[model samples]
Target: MKEYYPPPTPHEHDIEKMSNRITNARIEELEKLKERKDELKEKIKEKKDKMKEIRDAMERGDTADMILSSSAAALNKRGKETSNLTNEDLLEIQEMAIERLEEQFSKVEEELKQLKDMESS
Candidate 1:
């Protein structure tokens, strides 16, 4: 005598397709998140370089050219505003950029965790 097995449920294929679709979407989202993280890193590097240039100009006492290039002030008033970026202001700006980078890293980590969870499920 031959054994008999019941046919699979009609919704099984649909469920499988849905699961695959969700997985693919999560993968795409993860890729996008990684790209965004890279972009943020590049931005951080640019900001650091800018801060370094400003610091170096200040140290050399040759900030006139740097300030003039960076500001839109009238030639007469240029000396008053742009060169007034104290060390404190530079430090504050750098700190803010660092904080923003940290926040972006945290968000990327969280998204990675979620993607891993979805993959496991």
Candidate 2:
């Protein structure tokens, strides 16, 4: 019996190289996901600040931008929150909210999940 380290073929080396490339790509994909989640978190904070501005405008009887800005801010905030939701969390939130009982809790739970996932990941 021969103790063997067979000479690597071109095909074999290509396969190993392709595997490494795939692993690198997967890592980049995960990094992009992490970056997107972080961006959404910052967006949520921006939406909160924008909402405060809109509320102040409304209180001061400045309806010119209040209607548009307030609605837009709400939409932005909702989008930011939803982007951070996992598939399961989203399904649960949708179910709870649609039920219309303690509906606000659904939103709170979703936001909490987003925050927790963001932190842990």
Candidate 3:
């Protein structure tokens, strides 16, 4: 014949303390996530604002004027500056700026989705 042993039970106080600790940890995690989300939102807003500024500058013909007014040495980093900038250069810069902003927006959106999934889990 084999003797049977009873399972050990946790004390009520210990159980309650453990539950509280878990809850507090979860709450802290949520708060940190929310804070990060807010920060990301702010960054997105700033990027959008910059994109708008760039668009507005292009629309007002300010970009061309500014480039034309500045010395080639001042505008070009390579020191092999051309006497005149082509429309293509301006368009390319604008396109690159827009693409960068879009990339940032997408990355933040993905992060937000992951955070939501974590919260649900």
Q: lDDT of each prediction vs. the true structure?
A: 0.74, 0.57, 0.64
Overlapping backbone residue pairs in candidate 2 total 0
- The runs of at least 3 residues in candidate 1 whose Cα sits more than 4 Å from the true structure, single-residue gaps closed, are 1-8, 63-65, 73-84
lDDT of 3 at 2: 92
Evaluate model 3: give its lDDT. 0.64
Q: What ranges in model 2 sit over 4 Å off?
A: 60-62, 65-121
**Model 3: per-residue lDDT, tens digit, 1-121?**
8998776567866888898998787677667756765775676577566556656666776655364554655647566655554545655665676577567657656765775686688
Quick one: best lDDT, which candidate?
1
Candidate 2 TM-score versus the reference: 0.45
TM-score of each: 0.71, 0.45, 0.50
What is the TM-score (0 to 1) of candidate 1?
A: 0.71
Each candidate structure's count of clashing pairs? 0, 0, 0
- In terms of lDDT, the poorest run of 10 residues in model 2 is 81-90
Q: After aligning candidate 1 to the native by TM-score, how far in Å is the CA of 71 from where it should be? A: 2.2
Whole-model alpha-carbon lDDT for candidate 1: 0.74
